[model samples]
Target chain A: MSARRGAGVALFVIPALLGACSEEERAAAAPAAPAAVASASGTLDLELRDSLEIGLELLEDGSLRARVRAPRGFAVAADGAELSGVGRLVELRESEGTLYTARFSGAPVGGGPCGAEPVSLALSLHRRGDNAFVAGSLTPYCGADRWHGRPARTPLRLTGELPALAAPR
Target chain B: MSPPHRAPLGLAGAALVASALASSPAAAQEKFALAVFHFNAQYVAGGTLGFTLLPDPELDLDDPTTEDRIVTESLDPVLELYERHPSWGVDIEMQAYLLDVLGERHPAVLDRLRRMAKSGQLDVVSFHYSDQLFIAYPEEDWLRSQALAAETFARWDVPLGRSVFCQEGQAGRGLAARMVTAGYRTLMWPKNLLSYQRSEFDTDPFPLYRLGDAWMVPGGRSMDVTAGSTNISVRWTFMDDGELLATNDMNPYFPELFRHDPASVAAYEAEVAALEADGYVVSTVDDYVTHLETRITPREAPPLLDGTWQPGSTRAVAKWLGGKGLWPEERDAHVRSLDAAARRELVAAETAATAAGLDARERLDSAWRLLFLAEVSDASGINPFRGEMEYGLAHATEALRIASDTLAEAREALGLAGLAVDPESDAVTLATGADPLRGAAVAEAPLAIEVHAGDRATDTSWELVATGHHRVAIRFGAGDERQLWVGFPGDAAAPLVTTLALADSTPVSFDRAGFDFEEFWMALPVGLLSVGTDRFVIKDQATAHLAARIERGSGDVVFEDQTAPIGETATWVFHVFEGSAVDAVALAGRVNSHRRIER
Candidate 1:
């Protein structure tokens, strides 16, 4: 029933953003021209602060909506963010060559170096040619603590090439 | 390992293996008959349009491209397949309009179909021409639409199936009641070919189980050659295999399998055989129902439920608009527009036309037929394939147009000009017999009349003014419109009425189009009969203003003025519109103790 769910896929939900803006405000916020992502298939895995790693698989279900997964523990990547657990990329659209906007959310288990903090990340990405970059404010508290109503976030940014990969299921 | 006197050890082991094989998950094969249910639906042009900006598909009967696909592609291939495999049956679902189109485009194919139908090699499935949801229609409207479909098939000498198939194979609450009343036995879910509801069809011990008074055949995985290469191969699961039916939309199937690949066909047959050998029996849905009827079960009946096409969420349809799909806000807006128009114009017009006597019956039916076709469930919204929804809106608008025209005709025939209730005068003016076309007929005779407005003003000696025979103007002060009554002098040879008391005061014809009037008197024996416009309003003056349909049984006709009170003389009252044959006869019959209009 929530806009965050669809056909067994854990849809991308920017809870804070969704709750903060009305439909009109969101429409107004949409960029007049979003950049385009290449027709080729690819993946973007970025290692962030405290060994945190995020992986995005460009999935094809007729059109390009990505399959996303996140790091385990609270702070950093443990065994590298595996492209497991399918999550939908929301607002995955391209406009005005080389400008695209999309949002992703994921919370996978097991982060060794980050000390199993059970982190959950929500990121908004912009793609320019082969290069796709995302910058988001991450909550320092683990997903477990957040579940108990603790809110903590630190600014984070990452840029990386989207290497070609087999399309994720 | 075993006693010599007993079965040999090897033989015993072999017997155990065979037994296990028979009951294993692989042994879980059920009998399934492959029945390709074909559907070729088109949007009714000029019906209600959807809220989408998609280009609407035009309904061009002369254009072979549209209906041709239904035949050359869909039906032709199936017939060819049937010719090769006589036992493989295909069911074609169609409504009257589609059949008519088929008749025009592919008569030979249709004739072949008739032969196949006769030989039990093909089946014809009947559905509302509009393919509308039963829930959307009123009781009479629903029944009439169903009957019309049945009649269309009967007239064509084709036998229709008792089982109903709707989009998504979903039925709403009270579906059972409607189905039973219409003499239907089952509602088949076509979507079962693609989606499965484990709790409903798979998990339940019996998939073909009864739901309250009606029988439901739920979800099953359906795949066809046209389903893309990914779905071409058949996958059988032991749990949901009960009563599995395979369908092939031949014309639309992948080109590789269009002619029935020998290897693929052999493989399909092998699969069916494998299932049957394991313990399954193959039969069509009808035969399966018959089989179920012969079996006795103790499971409780499932209650009827309502929602969208699917059981749980309606998002499946909305899902189609996802990704690059912008929500069809325009589709919703168009739907609202259609609804508002129908409520304000169509419904009232239909009711009025129905009560306007035999002449207006055909017009009313035409309007209803168009309206029904425009409201198809999928074409209205569930389907976003093209501009299908837009066509529905167009059809609805056209239906409203027809209804408006019919209402005008009825009103003109009834000789209704307008009624103005001046709440300050305590008296009401009932305008009638205005001929805007030919000018108001000048009256050469005098007539007595009784006028009453809410018991405050009652005049038994009101006379028709000869000079302005077409005009009748009276203002009422603080009088309710419903309480106003006018009694015409029945004894006069004929009282000529020609105009209304409007500012223009033009003589309005009784049967011409475009004459405007608020409402008019009904069952009043005004001795004159006027034929001016092809349309007019028909109002029944009694305890309250009644819609045309409602006044069918309520209007009272009396032979003499004041001979009996309106309520007391209800029996002689036949509420015929002014231009109706009965209107003239009934008025003449009761006037001057003679001269009754012949039936």
Candidate 2:
């Protein structure tokens, strides 16, 4: 093989620190957009076709945070063996009555020159009533960065409903 | 004894044959087994800072704060794992320097290691003290470094196993010959670097081959579990990539996170089950060697190669260093300086001690140990982290000085005269005496010397000849006040030369369009340089440009450095036979040399 000099070929095998550094943790913890509501209760389960389960929770402010749980045989896509961990943060604003637009900004996981770049996902949902809702699939958008040594292009689809929020006291 | 010669086959053919043999159905019934070996050498060549971004360090050897974590987190688990799994044997090759660190700070770990060795669970193989590249230094220096490594292992009461486990799986010229001399029975290098394609490993009939006196197992297609891969069913070997097992708690492979899939463990178990069912013998590298030794009679010894063993045609150091902006000259020069100093020191210490009737083994041994500690391989120095490069260089410099000082002390104790040759500064330091040395073999004759105009000995090459009495044959050149034999021959009782100075000769200068010299002996359209009884540096007169050597009879050989002429006057250096009939004009015409020097 010809020499690949300074071609951004990171010679580091430091895979553990990927997606889990102090700076990245702080960034992932911070919400991307300001919230409109005061608080929220209950979780929204975006059940997908594959035994992959994504639990989204509405915060006190109007923002959504996700926790991913992989099936018994499978693992989280990019983070190898990380079955449960914080996934993504998206802004939730009501577009019309019973309709909501979820806006998500990319968040970097690993911290370093050669760390894996962030991949973002967005979703749109329509509420039938207070107890049930229909949601569209979240499209994974990873700009020219690699995850798990492969291009992060694997598509994600949501097949389940968002659970009812606890009624405000 | 010479190694057996295997008919060299084209690489393409070798790869195809290997690939075909890998899938052969007959292998299922045959004794197809694997030896799984795990090695952990947590070292950064220069340091974390030198290779990586500053302050953002993955591993910093200079920092004591990190050592505790490395020991408790990275090393402790592996030790514990070995103790827990007695049936799963392992061979660990630790950097001798790191072993010392462990001995000092973590004595408990040493006790554990001793226990493991006692239980026949772990065997410590011979390795470079600093994890240095064997090819980087001269053969003599390399052997000394290896010897010192054994001494370091003794410090921890660790026994030297028969095999030599080196990084990158590449052996330089004649390494096997030296290894045999050093008492190694088997040598193993990684398999990937040996061939351009991974499939090439299939062609070999067996895992081990005889190279000269030592048995060598060039990297896989061996039915071994050392290759780390999920597709062991398809891949010939089971080699681990060395990164799967985490060195610290943060590694995802940590014991807590190990159960997440546990693919490697499952793979190992499955392989053992399958191979055992087929009546194959599963064993470690050492055990495998022992097994082969016991089964194979004298007539059935492994096929030997004609010369020293070479794992691969390409050197990882050459490739890596080329990419890092440091070429062979930079590395070679530094290595040459270290080697010369060491050679003089060892010879001086031994000779002086003998003259003074004092034991010098302890002092020489100390110097040897220091030299070994400073011998960093190609895998080192490329660490982009902070402090690694500086750390290595600092220690190497200190060690060289200690060796030099010890030699000086030996000379002083014996009241023996000495000459010190400083290759870097091109100066000689002399200690005068009543009698000057005679009949010493400084270099082989007929001698050849090439000294450039500058004080730097980077361009100097010489073969010494002992002229009767106190005089030694030396070539005089353009360099002014260039000292010769500042350091006398290593012989302690031999007479030392007081001083030998060579005057700068009138140099043949070049002034014209830019010009360049080629390899030691190869010709360009303009001219050629050849090596015979003497070295020659033939240049164009337009303006002496950068000079280089080229061999005769080969036009396709690769030239090391290629630079365009800067249109400046430059002088090239060369040395020819003392009484050759070929004059400057005749020599110039032969090689198209517009400017020539045979002196």
Candidate 3:
């Protein structure tokens, strides 16, 4: 479905960087195994209950691709923010070893968010060793919005369907 | 409360508890499982496979010559034999072995098995389609083989059970114990152990026993089967020790055991004679496997190993790849490569226009969708590539065009990434085979529809799904539906084909280890899509082209004939480069390249 919707866990969608080496690149990046998550920021904000962890593999080309797994929204922390307009954008930042950031918002489906005001929040990416984790939350305008049926330990492993990725194949 | 009232209440309570216990899901407790034989009457390897035994014992006395005769002789008769006799019971074993080989109870024997099972004599049957051995096949492919075979058999009026395995044939691979876990109980015939062991005074025709409920082959020497008994069919042994009915010269005595083995043969004969005196009656697999139990169930425990053995095949290797967990490093890297390929594809598509006015980009998108679906089905082992859907018609011509463009995009993308794109490759391959015969065969390998662009040019691409000599009906012009019987690789007696579609792209299906295409030239409806190194423009319906290279090694096909079209262009084309069997080699390596001391 939508790239923004997936496992509610912190998904580091930073483009993957390339370091040309012999098999050495693999050896170095080898230890950086893709794991679900290891840490959390704090208790999830009640408002960000259903926020998906939209994960992606950020390529060095600044192009992103997604492999998705839906989010299970039970154990993440979120702090609500005030919305400016219908197209309000929420900024996010992360630092496992390096800082990664993105801004997310809903589109005008039939119209816009159900409520007059939508909540947005800024997030920081965290990484312990080589593993990355998302630790922030955003609030959709509608109170009925939910991440998914189940809050998974790991966000949905999404492939293709990223915002920056090409339209559906 | 009165003592008498309490006692009555207690009794009722106990009864209620018993009922609950009965309904609770538990491993079935059975003494013997009836594993019948199951095979597709129309299984074709490389071309059309004749289910009937060829070189009829009465006529040719050898390999099947005519596909129809082989079907009639080997398959139809067995069912007819049972049908004529209302009292006889049938057991269908699984079909295995390549279509090219014969002489034993090979997969081609399914026609007879199905006919008999269809006649209402089937007692137990293997759930698998082609009798690919478990050792050689990946677990997922084995599951599909069983699923599609049993499901298809059911369509022919043969009731199918849910589980099966070549337990006896497997010496070390404990697939049967897992079969139980997978859900199957009564096996038609567990291999190995013979009928009637000769030890001193006690000459016992090894009675039917159970290894976790799966039945062993009918328990009696082929020579000892009592002609009057109908309880079990005492079969002769193969060179490898599997049992078979006596088709050779009779040896000695013991014809009387068949009557005493399972049921009285005299009773069966009387019923058969009675039926022939009348006409055909309706029957199926359900009646047989559940023949004994008063309470009938549609399924049983997993097939028991019971020490049966089938050959271990390597054809299932590709199927297994997707099932096992991939290292994160490998998976991510692969994804990266796939992305690059996809991007190049999009670019190539936009640059060109196909016959349908659909740009190369649009067709390429369709190709990618199909590949994605095939990759995700999770069939396991044998490169269990799966497909989501098979979009019907509309693309019949456009599909070929897309297939052509996609092939070039794949090569260009792969090459740019420094990936070695094989030298030989056709553009598009579409799915052009029937059921049982269907699946993601190389429908249209990478090939082009026409050499020159024109309205009269026949848009063509090729594919090779289930192998066999087939003549499927196809109309490649603008909106044509005149049905034709194109040849695919399937049994002429009974043909199975897959559906076609664009939105649901699952065209390129392959389980290398499965060797699904091991036979050729039967009454199968097949289509092929072709591609070339250079752009092709079609001028006429007849395209005179010659296939020079056909290799899986190159992941595409090779062909000759400069600008001239090859073969008769159809709705689809089947092309490829080159392919070779891959073998695993053991490697000797040091535990650590830096280590020197042995602690």
Candidate 4:
């Protein structure tokens, strides 16, 4: 997507704020990628100029789609999600690259969301044509932000004690 | 010809006056039909955990400064605050209802809003749930939040009929897709000043929003022989959906009295007067819907867009925070706070809802709603960061200053005044005497504030701001939307004004276009409302236009004394990157370059 002078909050997910805040001058879209997901929740500092976690919704065919995890929804970027067809949005929280899990309730766009109890499901991801997609057709069972390494990286399970790290600042 | 008919003329005039008053439009008074709807939700930016925050005040400490960190990544200070305060939801509404401070939760302080809606005193739109963080949660959470919000609104008499996030610049729109899915013909958001086609351009923080259908004229086409017609659902591809950035939300969101000084108040009122004069209506989301339905034809559409976050704003401030070399750990502390606060509220709201007769299903829905939208409110996460950094640690330790304060005085004042409520009260206090810090974080401080920058910070090509508290304004400018930060604090209860000092010239050219440079004074006293690192794009005019920084002016310049009410308070906070004093700063204001701005 095009990069503008954006800043504040998580610059990687919804890079739009930084683009909007850019006081320098206008320019074309810039190919900036989301940063790596930090496993430690106690203190992981980042900004607009930093990297962001790219969410992927893998498909049966092996193609990929991407989307930006905005403050509101999976704001679809030029990069689509890894999943295709009717896979649901899941929280792949994890701790230091340990047990990776997938939690899904419903697909993006249509249908109601997953039920309560942050469901946990086993899943994984792979890249395709510059895009990362989530792969799986599993039924969700939990709803909490199960994976906990970093709120940045997608398709992972949460594990660290992210009290203030994951709550509100 | 006058003596005999004088009585009749007086009667005729009286009748005319009465008729005019009668037809003055029921919206003239404080009619419920003319309400101001606002979405008070805490919104997270597009990034996730592990992302680095731009800059923070806490990092202005020792030798080396570190970069790339989240603003709310630490909680040691906040936890310490809890140890000091000990009472969380004591004198405020746990759910953040404004009335909580006045003590009304138990039986209900008669929930004036509910009363208003029931008694036809409001065209109000209630919240999705409690403390819902917008944009960060999963998609299902968004749906559950919407349904829960609808349910809550139903209980409050403000049904979740349409999507009404009439807050400053943030709202939980996880339901945007759902709303479209649910088939809302005319969804609305804040439409600041940008007016053009029926594109889904995000709205600025204007007081009101106008809605119209973008995809109209769906065809029920069959074999075009001779069959009649039938209505068919037609969803067209959204035309304008690239990136819309709008800025300049100072006056629209904050009240004039917020600044606790002078300059900011003047800027605020100038905008208000213009809006009032322009006949801009301060209607609620429902009314906005009605207006478009009535005024806008199927062929017409209002600027339609979502994504109510401004990036280009607070330029000077952001740079300032970004360059901190002092307290390196402050950034870490700040980011930790965000997460902690979110979790805190998450836990609190959930526990409370579950504790209060809410079923597992309802509790889940409400919890999701809180995370999805209500959490995005000032009563949620943003303000807590403000309490963390005071003008200087100026008073408390860097980590604890702005984040929390000593509430002994605040609680006493409120309690004595019969304004403070029990923490267990039905109200959810946003900024109260109990938790003076953390904004939505809730601390035991005497004063606290949260900024609702109106709709001025929505999608736009340029910057536009709503002049005052509750009005819409249009700005005629160029491209690359500027920045917008809400800082209005004082309202009609205490209006603010600005006074530009006349140069030490003779006779002082009365009402002249220009004057020599000397000093400018703007008054606002909302010290608590300041988001330290948030730089604002302040524009004020004067022929001599003073310097940029806002320090007390010691230089003596000539003055012109006139007999008009000059608004009290020069409470503007300017960012003078290089200037040593604000008295020496300059300006780029128009109309009121020297023209008196009154609110």
Candidate with the greatest lDDT versus the true structure: 2
Q: Give the higher-TM-score candidate: 1 or 4.
A: 1
Predicted structure 2: lDDT: 0.36
- If both were scored by TM-score, which would come out higher, candidate 3 or candidate 4? 4
Worst 10 residues of 4 chain B by lDDT: B238-247
Residue lDDT tens for model 3, B1-599? 00111111122122323433443344322121122323332121111111123322233211122223333333344444455544434443434221212222334455555444444445334544443323321233344444444555554444443324342232211333444543554333322221111121124343332434342223212322221222222232121211112112211111211112112223434544453233212222233223222323222222221122221232112212211222111121112112122222222333322312343453354433322212221212222111000001111112222333343344344333212111112122221222221235245433322232233244333434333212121223422221211221212221121111110111122222222232211000011222222211111111111111222222232222211111212232222222211100000000000101100
TM-score of each: 0.42, 0.47, 0.27, 0.29
Task: Go through the candidates in order and give the C-alpha RMSD of each one to the true structure.
Answer: 28.9, 26.1, 25.3, 28.1
Q: Largest TM-score belongs to which candidate? A: 2
TM-score of 4: 0.29
Per-residue lDDT for A1-169 in model 1, tens only? 0112222133333334555888788767653222223233333322222233444444444123443334433333223333222322322111101211122222323442224444433333333122232222222224431211222221122233444334333
Superposition error at B590 for model 1 (Å): 36
Instruction: Tell me the docking grade of candidate 4.
Output: incorrect
Q: How would you encode candidate 4's per-residue C-alpha lDDT over A76-118 as one tens digit per residue? A: 1112222211112211110001111222222223221333222
RMSD of 4: 28.1
In order, the candidates keep a fraction of the true contacts of 0.00, 0.00, 0.00, 0.00
Candidates in order, interface RMSD in Å:
31.4, 32.7, 25.8, 21.6
